[model samples]
Target: MQDCRILITRPEPENTLSRERLHALGLASVPLPMLNIAPIKGPQEQAAIRAQIFDIDQFDYVIFVSKNAARLACDWLDACWPMLPVGVHWIGIGQGTTQTLLEEGVPALSNPGHTTEALLAWLKPAKMTNQKILIVRGAGGRPELGDKLAERGAKVSYLSLYERQKPIYTAQTFFMLPDVHLIWVTSGESLTNLTDYAEQHKPEWKCLPILTPSERVTLQAKEMGWVNARCAQGADDNSLIKATELHIGKQND
Candidate 1:
Protein backbone atom coordinates (compact mmCIF):
# COMPACT_ATOMS: atom_id res chain seq x y z
CA MET A 1 0.00 0.00 0.00
CA GLN A 2 2.92 2.33 0.68
CA ASP A 3 4.02 1.94 -2.93
CA CYS A 4 0.56 2.82 -4.30
CA ARG A 5 0.29 6.28 -5.84
CA ILE A 6 -3.36 7.42 -5.74
CA LEU A 7 -4.71 10.50 -7.43
CA ILE A 8 -7.50 12.23 -5.52
CA THR A 9 -9.98 14.22 -7.61
CA ARG A 10 -12.01 15.96 -4.93
CA PRO A 11 -11.89 19.74 -4.57
CA GLU A 12 -9.42 21.58 -2.34
CA PRO A 13 -9.79 21.47 1.46
CA GLU A 14 -11.79 18.27 1.04
CA ASN A 15 -8.89 16.88 -1.02
CA THR A 16 -6.53 17.92 1.76
CA LEU A 17 -8.31 15.71 4.27
CA SER A 18 -8.30 12.71 1.93
CA ARG A 19 -4.61 13.22 1.18
CA GLU A 20 -3.76 13.38 4.89
CA ARG A 21 -5.75 10.23 5.56
CA LEU A 22 -4.08 8.38 2.69
CA HIS A 23 -0.68 9.59 3.89
CA ALA A 24 -1.45 8.29 7.38
CA LEU A 25 -2.19 4.90 5.80
CA GLY A 26 1.24 4.93 4.10
CA LEU A 27 -0.14 5.62 0.60
CA ALA A 28 1.11 8.51 -1.50
CA SER A 29 -1.71 10.78 -2.78
CA VAL A 30 -1.58 13.43 -5.47
CA PRO A 31 -4.33 16.04 -5.38
CA LEU A 32 -5.81 16.71 -8.80
CA PRO A 33 -9.06 18.48 -8.08
CA MET A 34 -11.49 18.04 -10.97
CA LEU A 35 -14.30 20.14 -9.53
CA ASN A 36 -14.44 23.39 -7.59
CA ILE A 37 -17.31 24.53 -5.34
CA ALA A 38 -18.50 28.11 -5.54
CA PRO A 39 -21.27 29.53 -3.42
CA ILE A 40 -24.04 31.22 -5.40
CA LYS A 41 -23.47 34.87 -4.56
CA GLY A 42 -26.07 36.65 -6.67
CA PRO A 43 -28.70 38.76 -4.93
CA GLN A 44 -31.49 36.66 -6.40
CA GLU A 45 -29.86 33.45 -5.23
CA GLN A 46 -29.36 34.90 -1.75
CA ALA A 47 -32.96 36.07 -1.64
CA ALA A 48 -34.24 32.64 -2.67
CA ILE A 49 -32.22 30.85 0.00
CA ARG A 50 -33.35 33.39 2.60
CA ALA A 51 -36.97 32.80 1.59
CA GLN A 52 -36.53 29.07 2.07
CA ILE A 53 -34.87 29.54 5.45
CA PHE A 54 -37.66 31.91 6.47
CA ASP A 55 -40.14 29.06 6.03
CA ILE A 56 -37.98 26.39 7.56
CA ASP A 57 -40.60 25.30 9.99
CA GLN A 58 -43.05 24.41 7.22
CA PHE A 59 -40.83 21.60 5.95
CA ASP A 60 -41.48 18.14 7.29
CA TYR A 61 -38.09 16.71 6.26
CA VAL A 62 -34.90 18.58 5.47
CA ILE A 63 -32.42 16.48 3.50
CA PHE A 64 -28.80 17.46 3.13
CA VAL A 65 -27.08 15.86 0.14
CA SER A 66 -23.49 16.37 1.31
CA LYS A 67 -21.33 17.93 4.00
CA ASN A 68 -20.99 20.98 1.80
CA ALA A 69 -24.77 21.24 1.58
CA ALA A 70 -25.18 21.00 5.32
CA ARG A 71 -22.43 23.50 6.01
CA LEU A 72 -23.54 26.05 3.42
CA ALA A 73 -27.25 25.86 4.22
CA CYS A 74 -26.68 25.99 7.97
CA ASP A 75 -24.50 29.03 7.59
CA TRP A 76 -27.61 30.86 6.41
CA LEU A 77 -29.95 29.13 8.83
CA ASP A 78 -27.71 29.96 11.79
CA ALA A 79 -28.00 33.63 10.89
CA CYS A 80 -31.77 33.64 10.29
CA TRP A 81 -32.99 31.15 12.86
CA PRO A 82 -30.90 31.36 16.00
CA MET A 83 -33.06 28.68 17.54
CA LEU A 84 -33.83 26.06 14.93
CA PRO A 85 -37.46 25.14 14.60
CA VAL A 86 -38.40 21.95 16.37
CA GLY A 87 -40.16 18.88 14.86
CA VAL A 88 -38.59 19.26 11.44
CA HIS A 89 -36.83 15.96 10.91
CA TRP A 90 -33.35 16.48 9.46
CA ILE A 91 -31.94 13.85 7.11
CA GLY A 92 -28.27 13.67 6.21
CA ILE A 93 -26.94 11.51 3.40
CA GLY A 94 -23.88 10.24 5.26
CA GLN A 95 -21.79 10.41 8.43
CA GLY A 96 -19.76 13.42 7.31
CA THR A 97 -22.86 15.40 6.49
CA THR A 98 -24.48 14.30 9.71
CA GLN A 99 -21.42 15.34 11.71
CA THR A 100 -21.43 18.72 9.98
CA LEU A 101 -25.08 19.14 10.85
CA LEU A 102 -24.39 18.32 14.47
CA GLU A 103 -21.55 20.84 14.49
CA GLU A 104 -23.95 23.42 13.12
CA GLY A 105 -26.33 22.67 16.04
CA VAL A 106 -28.64 20.64 13.81
CA PRO A 107 -29.27 17.09 14.94
CA ALA A 108 -30.10 14.79 11.99
CA LEU A 109 -30.91 11.22 11.02
CA SER A 110 -28.10 9.84 8.92
CA ASN A 111 -27.59 6.58 7.08
CA PRO A 112 -24.61 4.74 8.51
CA GLY A 113 -24.17 3.04 5.14
CA HIS A 114 -23.51 6.42 3.48
CA THR A 115 -25.48 6.38 0.23
CA THR A 116 -28.76 7.79 -1.11
CA GLU A 117 -30.13 4.25 -1.48
CA ALA A 118 -29.29 3.62 2.15
CA LEU A 119 -30.96 6.84 3.26
CA LEU A 120 -34.06 6.07 1.19
CA ALA A 121 -34.21 2.58 2.68
CA TRP A 122 -33.95 4.04 6.17
CA LEU A 123 -36.80 6.50 5.45
CA LYS A 124 -39.13 3.98 3.81
CA PRO A 125 -41.22 3.39 6.92
CA ALA A 126 -42.03 7.07 7.36
CA LYS A 127 -45.30 8.54 6.14
CA MET A 128 -44.28 10.64 3.16
CA THR A 129 -47.65 11.65 1.72
CA ASN A 130 -48.51 15.32 2.10
CA GLN A 131 -45.11 15.93 3.63
CA LYS A 132 -43.02 18.87 2.49
CA ILE A 133 -39.32 17.97 2.04
CA LEU A 134 -36.48 20.39 1.45
CA ILE A 135 -33.24 19.19 -0.16
CA VAL A 136 -30.12 21.28 0.28
CA ARG A 137 -27.51 20.56 -2.37
CA GLY A 138 -25.22 21.93 -5.05
CA ALA A 139 -26.83 23.10 -8.32
CA GLY A 140 -27.62 20.56 -11.08
CA GLY A 141 -27.22 17.32 -9.17
CA ARG A 142 -29.16 14.16 -10.01
CA PRO A 143 -32.96 14.51 -9.75
CA GLU A 144 -33.58 10.92 -8.66
CA LEU A 145 -33.86 11.77 -4.95
CA GLY A 146 -36.45 14.53 -5.31
CA ASP A 147 -38.26 12.55 -7.98
CA LYS A 148 -38.47 9.48 -5.81
CA LEU A 149 -39.74 11.49 -2.84
CA ALA A 150 -42.33 13.14 -5.05
CA GLU A 151 -43.46 9.70 -6.22
CA ARG A 152 -44.36 8.97 -2.61
CA GLY A 153 -46.54 12.10 -2.58
CA ALA A 154 -44.04 14.35 -0.81
CA LYS A 155 -43.73 17.91 -1.99
CA VAL A 156 -39.99 18.22 -2.62
CA SER A 157 -38.27 21.57 -2.98
CA TYR A 158 -34.59 22.22 -3.58
CA LEU A 159 -32.39 24.91 -2.12
CA SER A 160 -29.22 24.93 -4.20
CA LEU A 161 -26.64 26.80 -2.14
CA TYR A 162 -23.58 26.12 -4.27
CA GLU A 163 -22.48 25.37 -7.83
CA ARG A 164 -19.76 22.98 -9.06
CA GLN A 165 -17.40 23.98 -11.84
CA LYS A 166 -14.44 22.35 -13.57
CA PRO A 167 -11.11 23.80 -12.63
CA ILE A 168 -8.75 25.11 -15.30
CA TYR A 169 -5.81 22.80 -15.79
CA THR A 170 -2.18 23.86 -15.95
CA ALA A 171 1.22 22.31 -16.67
CA GLN A 172 1.39 20.86 -13.16
CA THR A 173 -1.77 18.90 -13.89
CA PHE A 174 0.05 16.69 -16.39
CA PHE A 175 3.05 16.19 -14.12
CA MET A 176 1.16 13.89 -11.77
CA LEU A 177 -0.24 11.65 -14.50
CA PRO A 178 2.95 9.64 -14.93
CA ASP A 179 3.00 8.48 -11.31
CA VAL A 180 -0.74 8.05 -10.75
CA HIS A 181 -1.49 4.33 -10.33
CA LEU A 182 -5.11 4.62 -9.20
CA ILE A 183 -7.55 7.50 -9.60
CA TRP A 184 -10.12 8.10 -6.87
CA VAL A 185 -13.17 9.75 -8.37
CA THR A 186 -15.81 10.87 -5.88
CA SER A 187 -18.52 12.13 -8.25
CA GLY A 188 -19.77 11.55 -11.77
CA GLU A 189 -18.79 15.08 -12.74
CA SER A 190 -15.26 14.54 -11.52
CA LEU A 191 -15.00 11.32 -13.48
CA THR A 192 -16.21 13.09 -16.60
CA ASN A 193 -13.68 15.87 -16.15
CA LEU A 194 -10.91 13.38 -15.57
CA THR A 195 -11.76 11.39 -18.67
CA ASP A 196 -12.08 14.55 -20.70
CA TYR A 197 -8.70 15.71 -19.53
CA ALA A 198 -7.23 12.32 -20.27
CA GLU A 199 -8.67 12.21 -23.79
CA GLN A 200 -7.03 15.53 -24.58
CA HIS A 201 -3.68 15.09 -22.89
CA LYS A 202 -3.00 11.53 -21.76
CA PRO A 203 -5.29 9.19 -23.63
CA GLU A 204 -3.07 6.21 -22.82
CA TRP A 205 -3.83 6.66 -19.12
CA LYS A 206 -7.61 6.24 -19.58
CA CYS A 207 -7.50 2.59 -18.61
CA LEU A 208 -5.71 3.17 -15.29
CA PRO A 209 -7.33 1.53 -12.27
CA ILE A 210 -10.00 3.80 -10.81
CA LEU A 211 -11.84 3.69 -7.50
CA THR A 212 -15.28 5.22 -6.99
CA PRO A 213 -17.80 5.42 -4.15
CA SER A 214 -20.95 4.54 -6.11
CA GLU A 215 -22.10 2.04 -8.71
CA ARG A 216 -23.31 4.95 -10.80
CA VAL A 217 -19.79 6.38 -10.92
CA THR A 218 -18.32 2.97 -11.66
CA LEU A 219 -20.67 2.56 -14.58
CA GLN A 220 -19.80 6.03 -15.79
CA ALA A 221 -16.11 5.19 -15.75
CA LYS A 222 -16.67 2.00 -17.70
CA GLU A 223 -18.68 3.86 -20.31
CA MET A 224 -15.78 6.27 -20.61
CA GLY A 225 -13.48 3.29 -21.41
CA TRP A 226 -11.88 2.86 -18.00
CA VAL A 227 -10.85 -0.81 -17.73
CA ASN A 228 -10.56 -1.19 -13.98
CA ALA A 229 -13.19 0.90 -12.30
CA ARG A 230 -14.11 -0.46 -8.89
CA CYS A 231 -16.87 0.81 -6.58
CA ALA A 232 -16.08 1.10 -2.90
CA GLN A 233 -18.53 0.01 -0.21
CA GLY A 234 -19.39 3.60 0.74
CA ALA A 235 -18.61 7.26 0.13
CA ASP A 236 -16.03 7.84 2.81
CA ASP A 237 -12.26 8.06 3.18
CA ASN A 238 -12.12 4.77 5.07
CA SER A 239 -14.17 2.98 2.45
CA LEU A 240 -11.97 4.29 -0.33
CA ILE A 241 -8.82 3.29 1.51
CA LYS A 242 -10.10 -0.23 2.06
CA ALA A 243 -11.16 -0.52 -1.55
CA THR A 244 -7.76 0.66 -2.72
CA GLU A 245 -6.06 -1.87 -0.49
CA LEU A 246 -8.21 -4.66 -1.86
CA HIS A 247 -7.55 -3.57 -5.42
CA ILE A 248 -3.82 -3.58 -4.76
CA GLY A 249 -4.04 -7.00 -3.11
CA LYS A 250 -5.84 -8.41 -6.15
CA GLN A 251 -3.20 -6.97 -8.44
CA ASN A 252 -0.49 -8.61 -6.34
CA ASP A 253 -2.35 -11.94 -6.47
Candidate 2:
Protein backbone atom coordinates (compact mmCIF):
# COMPACT_ATOMS: atom_id res chain seq x y z
CA MET A 1 0.00 0.00 0.00
CA GLN A 2 2.90 2.29 0.80
CA ASP A 3 4.29 1.83 -2.68
CA CYS A 4 0.91 2.27 -4.40
CA ARG A 5 0.29 5.58 -6.09
CA ILE A 6 -3.31 6.55 -6.80
CA LEU A 7 -4.15 9.50 -9.01
CA ILE A 8 -7.22 11.43 -7.74
CA THR A 9 -9.24 13.13 -10.48
CA ARG A 10 -11.87 14.80 -8.33
CA PRO A 11 -12.10 18.60 -8.38
CA GLU A 12 -9.73 20.62 -6.16
CA PRO A 13 -10.42 21.33 -2.47
CA GLU A 14 -12.12 17.94 -2.42
CA ASN A 15 -9.11 16.31 -4.05
CA THR A 16 -6.91 17.81 -1.36
CA LEU A 17 -9.04 16.11 1.31
CA SER A 18 -8.89 12.78 -0.54
CA ARG A 19 -5.12 13.02 -0.88
CA GLU A 20 -4.71 13.85 2.80
CA ARG A 21 -6.83 10.83 3.77
CA LEU A 22 -4.83 8.55 1.48
CA HIS A 23 -1.58 9.92 2.88
CA ALA A 24 -2.80 9.16 6.40
CA LEU A 25 -3.33 5.55 5.31
CA GLY A 26 0.29 5.24 4.11
CA LEU A 27 -0.63 5.40 0.41
CA ALA A 28 0.58 8.05 -1.98
CA SER A 29 -1.96 10.21 -3.83
CA VAL A 30 -1.44 12.41 -6.86
CA PRO A 31 -4.08 15.08 -7.37
CA LEU A 32 -4.82 15.76 -11.03
CA PRO A 33 -8.13 17.66 -10.60
CA MET A 34 -9.75 16.87 -13.91
CA LEU A 35 -12.76 19.11 -13.27
CA ASN A 36 -13.04 22.73 -12.17
CA ILE A 37 -16.21 23.70 -10.35
CA ALA A 38 -17.29 27.31 -10.64
CA PRO A 39 -20.36 29.05 -9.39
CA ILE A 40 -22.92 29.93 -12.04
CA LYS A 41 -22.23 33.64 -12.47
CA GLY A 42 -24.91 35.18 -14.64
CA PRO A 43 -27.67 37.55 -13.53
CA GLN A 44 -30.27 35.28 -15.12
CA GLU A 45 -28.92 32.27 -13.26
CA GLN A 46 -28.81 34.15 -9.97
CA ALA A 47 -32.36 35.36 -10.50
CA ALA A 48 -33.50 31.85 -11.25
CA ILE A 49 -31.87 30.53 -8.08
CA ARG A 50 -33.52 33.29 -6.09
CA ALA A 51 -36.91 32.50 -7.62
CA GLN A 52 -36.48 28.83 -6.80
CA ILE A 53 -35.57 29.64 -3.22
CA PHE A 54 -38.61 31.90 -2.97
CA ASP A 55 -40.88 29.05 -4.01
CA ILE A 56 -39.10 26.32 -2.05
CA ASP A 57 -42.15 25.45 -0.03
CA GLN A 58 -44.06 24.44 -3.14
CA PHE A 59 -41.78 21.45 -3.68
CA ASP A 60 -42.71 18.27 -1.85
CA TYR A 61 -39.21 16.80 -2.00
CA VAL A 62 -35.84 18.45 -2.53
CA ILE A 63 -33.11 16.29 -3.95
CA PHE A 64 -29.43 17.23 -3.80
CA VAL A 65 -27.33 15.50 -6.46
CA SER A 66 -23.95 16.07 -4.78
CA LYS A 67 -22.31 17.54 -1.72
CA ASN A 68 -21.52 20.66 -3.73
CA ALA A 69 -25.18 21.03 -4.58
CA ALA A 70 -26.17 20.63 -0.95
CA ARG A 71 -23.61 23.16 0.21
CA LEU A 72 -24.55 25.74 -2.39
CA ALA A 73 -28.28 25.27 -1.99
CA CYS A 74 -28.05 25.44 1.78
CA ASP A 75 -26.06 28.63 1.53
CA TRP A 76 -28.85 30.14 -0.54
CA LEU A 77 -31.45 28.77 1.82
CA ASP A 78 -29.70 30.24 4.85
CA ALA A 79 -29.70 33.65 3.22
CA CYS A 80 -33.28 33.69 1.92
CA TRP A 81 -35.22 31.57 4.34
CA PRO A 82 -34.07 31.73 7.96
CA MET A 83 -36.27 28.75 8.84
CA LEU A 84 -36.57 25.78 6.54
CA PRO A 85 -40.08 24.98 5.43
CA VAL A 86 -41.67 21.95 7.05
CA GLY A 87 -43.28 18.94 5.31
CA VAL A 88 -40.67 18.88 2.54
CA HIS A 89 -38.50 15.82 2.75
CA TRP A 90 -34.90 16.42 1.76
CA ILE A 91 -33.02 13.69 -0.10
CA GLY A 92 -29.31 13.35 -0.79
CA ILE A 93 -27.85 11.19 -3.53
CA GLY A 94 -25.25 9.63 -1.23
CA GLN A 95 -23.82 9.65 2.26
CA GLY A 96 -21.40 12.47 1.49
CA THR A 97 -24.27 14.66 0.36
CA THR A 98 -26.27 13.63 3.39
CA GLN A 99 -23.39 14.58 5.66
CA THR A 100 -23.18 17.94 3.94
CA LEU A 101 -26.89 18.50 4.37
CA LEU A 102 -26.61 17.66 8.07
CA GLU A 103 -23.69 20.02 8.42
CA GLU A 104 -25.80 22.70 6.79
CA GLY A 105 -28.53 22.10 9.40
CA VAL A 106 -30.79 20.31 6.99
CA PRO A 107 -32.14 16.86 7.81
CA ALA A 108 -31.94 14.57 4.82
CA LEU A 109 -32.31 10.97 3.75
CA SER A 110 -29.57 9.45 1.61
CA ASN A 111 -29.44 6.56 -0.83
CA PRO A 112 -28.35 3.41 0.95
CA GLY A 113 -26.59 2.11 -2.14
CA HIS A 114 -25.13 5.50 -3.19
CA THR A 115 -26.41 5.48 -6.77
CA THR A 116 -29.15 7.22 -8.73
CA GLU A 117 -30.82 3.89 -9.50
CA ALA A 118 -30.82 3.11 -5.80
CA LEU A 119 -32.41 6.48 -5.02
CA LEU A 120 -35.03 5.90 -7.69
CA ALA A 121 -35.81 2.47 -6.27
CA TRP A 122 -36.15 3.93 -2.78
CA LEU A 123 -38.56 6.56 -4.09
CA LYS A 124 -40.69 4.04 -5.97
CA PRO A 125 -42.59 3.17 -2.81
CA ALA A 126 -43.61 6.76 -2.26
CA LYS A 127 -46.72 8.32 -3.76
CA MET A 128 -45.18 10.55 -6.41
CA THR A 129 -48.33 11.56 -8.25
CA ASN A 130 -48.47 15.32 -8.65
CA GLN A 131 -45.55 15.73 -6.25
CA LYS A 132 -43.16 18.60 -6.88
CA ILE A 133 -39.44 17.78 -6.59
CA LEU A 134 -36.62 20.29 -6.75
CA ILE A 135 -33.25 18.93 -7.91
CA VAL A 136 -30.24 21.07 -7.03
CA ARG A 137 -27.14 20.28 -9.05
CA GLY A 138 -24.54 21.60 -11.48
CA ALA A 139 -25.49 23.13 -14.82
CA GLY A 140 -25.15 19.89 -16.78
CA GLY A 141 -25.69 16.45 -15.30
CA ARG A 142 -27.55 13.23 -16.01
CA PRO A 143 -31.23 13.82 -16.85
CA GLU A 144 -32.14 10.32 -15.72
CA LEU A 145 -33.29 11.37 -12.26
CA GLY A 146 -35.69 14.00 -13.54
CA ASP A 147 -36.87 11.75 -16.36
CA LYS A 148 -37.51 8.88 -13.99
CA LEU A 149 -39.32 11.08 -11.50
CA ALA A 150 -41.45 12.54 -14.25
CA GLU A 151 -42.30 9.03 -15.41
CA ARG A 152 -43.49 8.30 -11.88
CA GLY A 153 -45.95 11.24 -12.13
CA ALA A 154 -43.86 13.75 -10.25
CA LYS A 155 -43.16 17.28 -11.39
CA VAL A 156 -39.40 17.88 -11.35
CA SER A 157 -37.61 21.23 -11.41
CA TYR A 158 -33.90 21.82 -11.67
CA LEU A 159 -31.92 24.55 -9.92
CA SER A 160 -28.50 24.69 -11.54
CA LEU A 161 -26.27 26.00 -8.77
CA TYR A 162 -22.83 25.54 -10.30
CA GLU A 163 -21.03 24.76 -13.53
CA ARG A 164 -18.51 21.98 -14.13
CA GLN A 165 -15.66 22.81 -16.45
CA LYS A 166 -12.82 20.65 -17.73
CA PRO A 167 -9.57 21.83 -16.26
CA ILE A 168 -6.85 23.21 -18.52
CA TYR A 169 -3.87 20.87 -18.31
CA THR A 170 -0.73 22.00 -16.51
CA ALA A 171 2.76 20.59 -16.03
CA GLN A 172 1.81 19.40 -12.55
CA THR A 173 -1.20 17.58 -13.88
CA PHE A 174 0.83 15.79 -16.55
CA PHE A 175 3.72 14.97 -14.24
CA MET A 176 1.71 12.44 -12.17
CA LEU A 177 0.25 10.51 -15.11
CA PRO A 178 3.20 8.16 -15.57
CA ASP A 179 3.65 7.14 -11.93
CA VAL A 180 0.02 6.45 -11.09
CA HIS A 181 -0.91 2.82 -10.50
CA LEU A 182 -4.61 3.63 -10.13
CA ILE A 183 -6.75 6.57 -11.24
CA TRP A 184 -9.70 7.38 -9.00
CA VAL A 185 -12.45 8.72 -11.23
CA THR A 186 -15.41 10.26 -9.38
CA SER A 187 -17.48 11.16 -12.43
CA GLY A 188 -17.86 10.26 -16.11
CA GLU A 189 -16.59 13.69 -17.12
CA SER A 190 -13.50 13.25 -14.97
CA LEU A 191 -12.83 9.86 -16.55
CA THR A 192 -13.19 11.32 -20.02
CA ASN A 193 -10.89 14.25 -19.23
CA LEU A 194 -8.28 11.89 -17.80
CA THR A 195 -8.35 9.61 -20.86
CA ASP A 196 -8.30 12.53 -23.28
CA TYR A 197 -5.18 13.85 -21.57
CA ALA A 198 -3.62 10.41 -21.59
CA GLU A 199 -4.39 9.84 -25.28
CA GLN A 200 -2.79 13.11 -26.21
CA HIS A 201 0.22 13.16 -23.90
CA LYS A 202 0.79 9.59 -22.65
CA PRO A 203 -0.98 6.82 -24.53
CA GLU A 204 0.39 4.10 -22.30
CA TRP A 205 -1.25 5.72 -19.25
CA LYS A 206 -4.72 5.19 -20.72
CA CYS A 207 -4.68 1.54 -19.68
CA LEU A 208 -3.92 2.23 -16.04
CA PRO A 209 -6.31 0.81 -13.45
CA ILE A 210 -9.24 3.18 -12.85
CA LEU A 211 -11.41 2.96 -9.78
CA THR A 212 -14.76 4.66 -10.36
CA PRO A 213 -17.59 5.54 -8.02
CA SER A 214 -20.25 3.72 -10.00
CA GLU A 215 -20.63 0.95 -12.57
CA ARG A 216 -21.78 3.53 -15.14
CA VAL A 217 -18.46 5.36 -14.73
CA THR A 218 -16.57 2.06 -14.84
CA LEU A 219 -18.26 1.20 -18.15
CA GLN A 220 -17.46 4.71 -19.39
CA ALA A 221 -13.80 4.24 -18.49
CA LYS A 222 -13.74 0.84 -20.21
CA GLU A 223 -15.39 2.23 -23.33
CA MET A 224 -12.78 4.99 -23.33
CA GLY A 225 -10.09 2.21 -23.64
CA TRP A 226 -9.03 1.94 -20.04
CA VAL A 227 -8.03 -1.72 -19.62
CA ASN A 228 -8.67 -2.07 -15.91
CA ALA A 229 -11.74 -0.19 -14.66
CA ARG A 230 -13.48 -1.11 -11.44
CA CYS A 231 -16.36 0.38 -9.43
CA ALA A 232 -15.93 1.35 -5.81
CA GLN A 233 -18.67 0.99 -3.16
CA GLY A 234 -19.47 4.71 -3.14
CA ALA A 235 -18.23 8.14 -4.21
CA ASP A 236 -16.92 9.25 -0.81
CA ASP A 237 -13.21 9.62 -0.06
CA ASN A 238 -13.35 6.68 2.39
CA SER A 239 -14.93 4.44 -0.23
CA LEU A 240 -12.26 5.34 -2.76
CA ILE A 241 -9.55 4.63 -0.22
CA LYS A 242 -11.07 1.27 0.71
CA ALA A 243 -11.42 0.26 -2.93
CA THR A 244 -7.86 1.29 -3.69
CA GLU A 245 -6.51 -0.68 -0.72
CA LEU A 246 -8.55 -3.72 -1.69
CA HIS A 247 -7.35 -3.58 -5.27
CA ILE A 248 -3.77 -3.20 -4.11
CA GLY A 249 -4.16 -6.13 -1.70
CA LYS A 250 -5.51 -8.29 -4.48
CA GLN A 251 -2.67 -7.33 -6.76
CA ASN A 252 -0.15 -8.18 -4.04
CA ASP A 253 -1.88 -11.52 -3.39
**Top TM-score hit:** 2
Candidate 1 whole-model C-alpha lDDT, 0 to 1: 0.86
Task: Extract clashing residue pairs from model 1.
Answer: none
What stretches of model 2 exceed 4 Å from their correct place?
170-178
Taking every candidate in turn, the Cα RMSD to the unseen true structure, in Å, is 1.7, 1.5
Q: Ten-residue segment with the worst summed lDDT in candidate 1? A: 170-179
Per-model TM against the reference: 0.94, 0.95
Against the true structure, whose lDDT is highest?
2
Q: Write the per-residue lDDT of candidate 2 for residues 6-104, one digit (tens) a residue.
A: 888889778998889888888888888989989887998899899999899999999999888998899999989989999999999988889989988
| Candidate 1 lDDT by residue in tens digits, 1-253 | 7778998998866899989998888889888899999999999889988998999899999999987898888899889998999989998987777888998889887876777877777677458888999999999988988888888888999999999999999656696555788889888888899898888877767778888878878898899899888898666787888899899998889
Clashing pairs in 2: none
Q: In model 1, which regions exceed 4 Å deviation?
A: 176-178
Q: What's the true lDDT of residue 217 in model 1?
A: 82
